[model samples]
Target: MTHEITDELQGIKVLVTGGAGFIGSNLCEFLLNNNAIVHCLDNFATGHRENISSFLNHPNFTLFTGDIRNLTDCKNAVSSMDYVLHQAALGSVPRSINDPITTNEVNVSGFLNMLTATRDEGVKRFVYAASSSTYGDSTTLPKEEDIIGKPLSPYAITKYVNELYANIFHKVYGVDTIGLRYFNVFGRKQDPNGAYAAVIPKFVKQLIDHQSPVINGDGSFSRDFTYIDNVIEMNVKAMLSIHPDAANNVYNVAYGERTTLIELLGILKEELAQYDTAIKDIEIQFGPERVGDVPHSLASIDKAKSLLGYAPVFDIKKGLQASVDWYWEHLK
Candidate 1:
């Protein structure tokens, strides 16, 4: 099994906030696949309803169409769950730059609601989604867990604030918290046509539709570009394990490898050219660098590997190929 959910999490009660988005939906599927009674809460602000439509009928699954920014909603959702996976938040650097207030409301205030709810509810473990953008201006090559710079965007500030709040909960309320700093995760069921869609799916969609995919900057900036399976592993490990030293810590969930934009476009073209050879001829356009964008990002997974026993399964090429195949089948 490419993503066999371990029995450690089986039979556990889980509340996955933002359960309709790319990573949240995948986590919901993995939990159900492993026999956990799962509850999903989403407001459909950035997440799509169609993403979890297939799981609506599962006996072990409960879908609550709600927002995390509301304390009552987060409190009601967290009351019965043994573990909480907080994945909901507004994403995208430019979107956050344009609308920092909404981003703050959703990502910052919304995170605090979840934190307060989970702590008060006496949940066994709380694992939330953090972002690599927390490494705002460090100029470091492969980001480590302990060392971090200031935030670059409003979105980044929200994610960094997640860590801060989690730490406070752990210290003040004795709520066990863990943060997975995800770096460029992409795979199946990702929304391709959204205003804030991620790069892999967005690029693949344009390439398939015979549209030029715009590369911001000179196409030389790079990222770790982790896959969904690896991210799922990190979450499961963080939730299921009972390591004394690992609690109240943050770890980067990413492939330890780096790939440039030009290399990524080449790979996307190579994969998509199989179905539509004309994709090979689709010219890639360049644009000036966007605000609040990092020039490069890579992760050092030693912390995750040693502590939570985290092991990532796919690299950029394999992950992008899987993404391309999935989008081709589902987006048609």
Candidate 2:
């Protein structure tokens, strides 16, 4: 999993805010593998300890039990870090809808705390996990960075606000920031049991249990499903990018392709059937379309490609196969 971009991380002090969660833990692992000094800050709200248990004893790895909402906690974790990967936001549109107040407290106020800490600490670069949900109701294909419609959910509004805060932080405080808008990332260690679990892992868990996975609509809704590896690569690139115009810019982190739910289910079943033949016979159930879900999603990765030299090594099929193998081996 080592890439040329990771070479810049050798000996660098990096802090991952939600290092016990899926994407955050993966980033911590990648940083450690590349010989970076990794410090993780997490409170275990939505994160699991087992995700980072294997790295707890690593010489360069340190874990700090803290929440992002606390300014002192953020400052303490970021004290000596050279780079900050801010991933400690409350995710899920449904969760935000159910509890918009908490979502705002964490995603907005907490993000401000982290950004302020990064600036005060003089971190060289701040890279945070922005979301594709920020695209909102924009009916454009191959979504470009600059154009976005009104946010359709509290979660989306929070993410969009993050971009605004990052831009303002750079202009006002002179903090170097890069925002990577991830598109439906899925991979190993992604929790499959939660109510807000991502579609790929949720459906994989259902199929593994011989339970019919339900589609939210007629299965026509599509998404630009990004792999965790691709996301890690982009994060590294953003952290290390020296392009004169790269700072304070947000880039789309995706494979630049889309797959509908029906098509996704078909591929998932085929991939799982290799281990369990019975999975192929399991049917899909259709339900009402989820509110706040866009009809389609696709990304124009040209900005990242040109500025950060991002080249995604895994497409949806390859990513799904890898995810299915992990889920079968670990969950089954």
Candidate 3:
């Protein structure tokens, strides 16, 4: 799927919260490349300076080092911006479970701050990063946007609350908003060294180092592992979309296919073998299932397709191959 760069995006000022993190940093780079004046706001709590270091000197890029929890900072960042891409939030389920108060402060309270700032600033569109975890406890194979079940974890609850808030803000305050419930997004610049690191990046790093990767369960669990570029495309589409039904709504951002954990590991090993044959011989370990983990997850992206014209360009195999190549060259 090819995304056309529109002239309206050029010279437009946009604020990307969490702009130093994985998906947010990718958005910043893509927007800057399209001649957009990009302002990056991050607290560096989970985001890193290294991710934005390369583009720090770009003439169109500006970095605002501040926490979203502070209303003043949120107002400062949202000022004079045409659009707000709110991506700053505590991400991991385990982290949120262990520290619910801090998670609520950042994800819930900080989100409220951004929404208030955006409304006051009269931003054109407020696009945010929602999560697939919001579909917790649902046994549906291909989860749809409207069929979400009760949230199973603190992180899930926070994200679901974001959807509710975005809807209220749109109806009462007339703040135009869109939410993209992202699936398991992974790719280049994604940190693979943290305790809450995503499975794909962590496994890729371990494979590169010829170390064993421990699967959380019996390897039967599956996910609609989305690629970063596909996610970037959705955000851009959401920003540019002017369709009446596109605003004040949520859409699933994913590849729309499921891959089991065992399948994922096999593909990773196959792709990494091109760099070093020995990587294929690395042992795999099994561990107990993680708490708050759902057995399977898949997304129905028909809404995004029909409303925003979203078309994911990479499938699991293609995306995994690209990600593996990136880790091999960068981490090896």
Model 1, 166-250: lDDT tens digits are 9998999999999999999999988888778888889988888899999999999999999998988899899988787888999
Root-mean-square deviation of each candidate, in angstroms? Answer: 1.0, 0.9, 1.1
Candidate 2 residue runs with Cα over 4 Å from true position: 2-6
Q: Candidates sorted by lDDT, descending order?
A: 2, 3, 1
Q: Tens digits of per-residue lDDT for model 2 on 154-225? A: 999999999999999999999999999999999999999888998999999999999999999999999999
| Candidate 3, pairs of clashing residues | none
Candidate 2, residue 213: lDDT: 98
How does candidate 1 fare on TM-score?
A: 0.98
Indicate the worst ten consecutive residues by lDDT in candidate 2.
1-10
Query: By TM-score, how accurate is candidate 3?
Result: 0.98
For each candidate, what TM-score against the reference?
0.98, 0.99, 0.98
Once fitted onto the true fold, the runs of candidate 3 whose alpha carbons sit more than 4 angstroms away are 1-8
List where candidate 1 sits over 4 angstroms from the true fold: none
